[model samples]
Target: MPLPVPDRLCDLPYAHLLTPHTGPLRSDERYDTVHFDGGEYTDQRAGGATFLECAFTGVALSGVKLRQARFNEVWAQAGRWVGCDLSESEWQDSAVTGGVLAGVSAHGSALRRTVFRGCKLEAVNLRAAVLRDVVFEDCLLRDVDFGDARLTDVSFPGTTLEEVRLRGARLSRADLRGAVSLGLPDGHQGLQGAVISSTQLLELAPQFAHALGITVKD
Candidate 1:
């Protein structure tokens, strides 16, 4: 099984003035094609909000809670997000590049046709999320949780996955050849159609044997 090539991101223009952040954000509001460049947002809560064709460049978000939000065709580059909660959010056709996301929780989110490149993800929780046609390249993911997530056509190249939890997560045509420290726990049964190198297979032999209920002989 091979990975599906995702569509290229389109450039969206900013047509509105820069709205200064002051208090709590509105829910179910449409942020129509706004551009956030070099902006800093703090303590904003935008649950169930929609961001269509928006671009976020060099933006910094701290203490933001966007639970169940929707981001369609958004491009976020060179941004930093700390302590943000995006649980159950829907991010479709989005590209997040060169970003540092620390302590962000996106548990049960849906990420379709998304690309996350050259980013540092620390303590990010994506448990039970739906990930389809996602590419995570050259990213450093530490303590990230992908438990029970459905991954289809997902590839992780040149990425460091340390302490990542992938229990019961399905993989369809996922390429992890260049990933480092990718240790699957014992009895992991969702590695079908996953591509890895010989070295990785050898390193994961113990877990594989355990999954097969095989006992090593002395």
Candidate 2:
């Protein structure tokens, strides 16, 4: 069953923050139009929390657990998340821009109409996540895993993917027109159903030929 949304924001602890708990902390909490800027949190457990129309700017979180949390119309800008676990979270109409998410686990999460721009993601696990109408622009992804993730209507513009794995991810309608990456597994990489101009294809023909060992005769 879905947890009930809280009426007020809970007071955050100040010191001795890195203890791991069994159950959810700050569960069923809700915040409407709340602002949290330049706050730092470490080793806190917050699962099944809900945020509505909240803004989190310049907040740094580390070793935080957020399972089954729901974020609707939230804006998180210039925040950093390190070693955080956000499995089974649901984000709708949210925007996360200019953040660094390192060693984060977002397995089985669902994002709809979400935008992540100019973010740095390293060693992030997004296994079995569902993304629809999501945009990732100017992001740096290193050692990120998106295995078995569902991607529909997703677009990545000017993103750099280094050592990232997308194995078994459904990307039939994903657009990666300006994404930079070495390659993918099983020869299923690159834009499949994305729209590109004729000039762009012409410019990439030689590179594609070199990769496929195709000889072009003049």
lDDT for each residue of candidate 2 in 102-174, tens digit (9 for 90 to 100): 9999999998888888899999999899988888878998887878888888877788877767667777577
Model 1 per-residue lDDT at 102: 95
Number of the top TM-score candidate: 1
lDDT, residue 196, model 2: 45
As a TM-score, model 2 comes out at: 0.76
Residue 167, candidate 1: how far off, in angstroms? 0.7
Q: For residues 80-103, what per-residue lDDT tens digits would candidate 1 score against the true structure?
A: 999999999999888898999999
Q: How well does model 1 score by local distance difference test? A: 0.80
List where candidate 1 sits over 4 angstroms from the true fold. Answer: 1-25, 185-189, 210-218
- The root-mean-square deviation over C-alpha atoms between each candidate and the true structure, in angstroms, is 3.9, 8.0
